[model samples]
Target: MPERAPHGTSPSHPSPEAYAALESLLRASPRGRWFLAEYARRNRTAETEMLLEAIARIERAVLKPAPRQAVPSNV
Candidate 1:
């Protein structure tokens, strides 16, 4: 991974978080399949696999709700 620039800015390359978010969005949104396929084809063999994994992760995240935190009573 590239070192972070001062003030949390990426000097040239984007972060992995950004790539994951984009892959998730591209997989879910309409007309995104074309983008994913084309991107996958342009990249190496593992790119498509990674895209699939990202989609699966996004689906799971959307389907699963976060756990609720219990609050102590003041009474």
Candidate 2:
């Protein structure tokens, strides 16, 4: 039997890996990339933008600036 989603609730957000896959697929085809971006923008889906924003935030968080190592003092 197929599992059902809880009533009045949708599935949770996709994983970062899944979102990265989707972004990669979209970029694979120029036309598809353009269309989805335009459609998503036109529809004004906060969810879509939020997902993209989350991805961006995740990327930044994962790749923060590294602390600079101090050089040895010259004699």
Candidate 3:
């Protein structure tokens, strides 16, 4: 694996939720996918995989939240 850019010095090592957001953006954009692929190629490392997994976990967590309904107002 390639060496990381030191702790806290790299890309802020965003949270799982942040990663999921990135994944969403990538999926929503054709150019984003290309960007991700190119980025991975240039900065291949264990951290990258971890980031991707974090993204997946975040997606699951966000989607698993319970739904709430608004109460009806009395006329």
Each candidate: RMSD: 14.9, 12.4, 15.7
Encode model 3's per-residue lDDT on 1-75: one tens digit a residue: 965786768545789999999799897888998898888887787778889999999999998968887878973
Backbone N/Cα/C clashes per model = 0, 0, 0
Estimated TM-score for each candidate: 0.37, 0.41, 0.38
Clashing pairs in 2: none
lDDT per residue (tens digit) for residues 1-72 in model 2: 977789999977889999999889888999978988898787788777888999999999989998899988
CA lDDT, every model vs. true structure: 0.84, 0.88, 0.85
lDDT of 1 by residue, 1-75 (tens): 966678967587659999898889988966897888876777866787899999999999999988998877874
Off by over 4 Å in 2: 1-7, 43-75
* Candidate achieving the largest TM-score: 2
Worst 10 residues of 3 by lDDT: 3-12
Regions of model 3 farther than 4 Å from truth: 1-12, 45-75
Model 3: clashing residue pairs? Answer: none
Among all windows of 10 consecutive residues in model 2, the one with the lowest summed lDDT is 39-48
Q: Look at candidate 1 and tell me the lDDT of residue 12.
A: 74
TM-score, cand. 2: 0.41
